[model samples]
Target: MLSSLVVSCSITTSELLASKAYGAAQTYPVAPDRAWKIVRAIVDTTAAVAVEERREDGVLIATTESHDWHVATRFAIWIEPVEAGTRLIVVSRTVRPGAFPRALSEKEFHRDFAQRVVGNDLDSHGPKGK
Candidate 1:
C-alpha cells in the first residue's frame, strides 16, 4: 500500500512602498500589548540606535547604519488597538542610496512578526512535494 500527502498555499501582495517610504499594515489576532511586544523586539534587535520611543502612545522610531555597507535606514512602528485584534503599521526609509530598502525591511519584519504571532514558519518558497 502507498500513502500520499497534499498541501495548499496562497500568495498575495498585502503592502507596497511609495515615495521612498515603505509601509505595511497587518492585523494579528492578539491583544495590543502582545503585538507591541513583537514590534519592540524587532526594533531592539535590528536598530542601530533608538532615536525616539513612545510606549504610552505605541510608537517606536529607530535609526540604523551599516558601517561596513554604508547603508543608513530609519524605522517607525505603530501599534493600535482594534476590534479584531491589534493593528500594526510599519514604515521605513533609507538615507543611503538604495532601491526599495523600506519595502525590503517591511517584508522581512512582517514575515517574522506574522510567524511569531501564528506560531509557524511562513516560508514563502514554493511548496516541496515529498
Candidate 2:
C-alpha cells in the first residue's frame, strides 16, 4: 500500500520553534505549516520570492510572497503577538499574483483560500471568531 499526503503536521508554533527556542508556546494540529512550506517552495522556485524578515522581543517574524501570471501566488503570514495577548495571526492568500491576463482565476483562488483554509467571515477575532 502507498500513502499520498498533500498536507501534514500542525502550523503550531511550539512544534516549529520547538527546536528553535522559546517557551509558553502552543501548537495546533492542522495543515497550515505544511501548506506554508509547500507554498513557499513552489512559488520560490517557479516564480520569485519577495520576503521580509524582522525580529521583535525574541520571536523571528517573516513574510514571504511570490508572483506569477501562469499560477497563483502564495501568501502565508504568521504573526505572534505578545503583549496584552499571546496569540498568532495568520493570513494565507492564494492570489493570481496580480491583475493582468487571467485575473478571474486569481479571484477564484483568493475566494477559496478565504472560505476554505481560513474561514468565511474573518472578523477581528480568533479562528473561531470569539
Candidate 3:
C-alpha cells in the first residue's frame, strides 16, 4: 500500500510538471506571416519530425528523435501578432514520464531563431549574385 501511494504521488508530480509551460516568449520586429515562415523553417530543420502544423492558428508541434535517456522531446510553439510585432512562445517537455529532459531550452531556441531571422534579412538586402 505504501509503495502504491508513493507511485501515485510521483505520477502526479510528473504530470503537473509536464503540463506546465517550460519556455520563453520573445517578440520580433516582423510581421506574423514572415515570422510564421521563419518559424516553420526552423522547426523543420531542427525537429526530427513535425507532428502537427496549423498556420492559421499559428501553432506548431514537433518531436525530436529518442536518445538513450529519453523516449523523445516534444516542442509546442505558438506565433501570434502583437502590437509591436510577432510574439513567439515555445514550450518543450519530455514525452515519457521519468525520462530525462533533453529538449532544447527556450534561450537556445530563441538565439537560433534570431540568427535565422537576421540572416534572412541580410540575405534579402545584400547584393544579388551575377
RMSD of each: 15.6, 14.0, 9.0
- In model 1, the Cα lDDT at residue 64 comes to 63
Off by over 4 Å in 1: 1-22, 100-104, 120-130
Q: Model 3 over residues 35-106: C-alpha lDDT tens digits?
A: 877766666555444356777767766666666644556676778899999988887665556747555656
* C-alpha local distance difference test of each model: 0.57, 0.32, 0.62
TM-score, candidate 3, is 0.67
TM-score, each model?
Answer: 0.64, 0.24, 0.67
Candidate scoring better on TM-score of 1 and 3: 3
Decreasing lDDT order of the candidates = 3, 1, 2
Worst ten-residue run, lDDT, model 1?
A: 1-10
Error at 70, model 1, angstroms: 6.7
With candidate 2 superimposed using the best TM-score fit, by how many Å does residue 127's alpha carbon deviate from the native? 24
lDDT of 2 at 48: 34
lDDT of 1 at 21: 39
Which is the winner by TM-score between candidate 1 and candidate 2? 1
Clashes of 2: 0
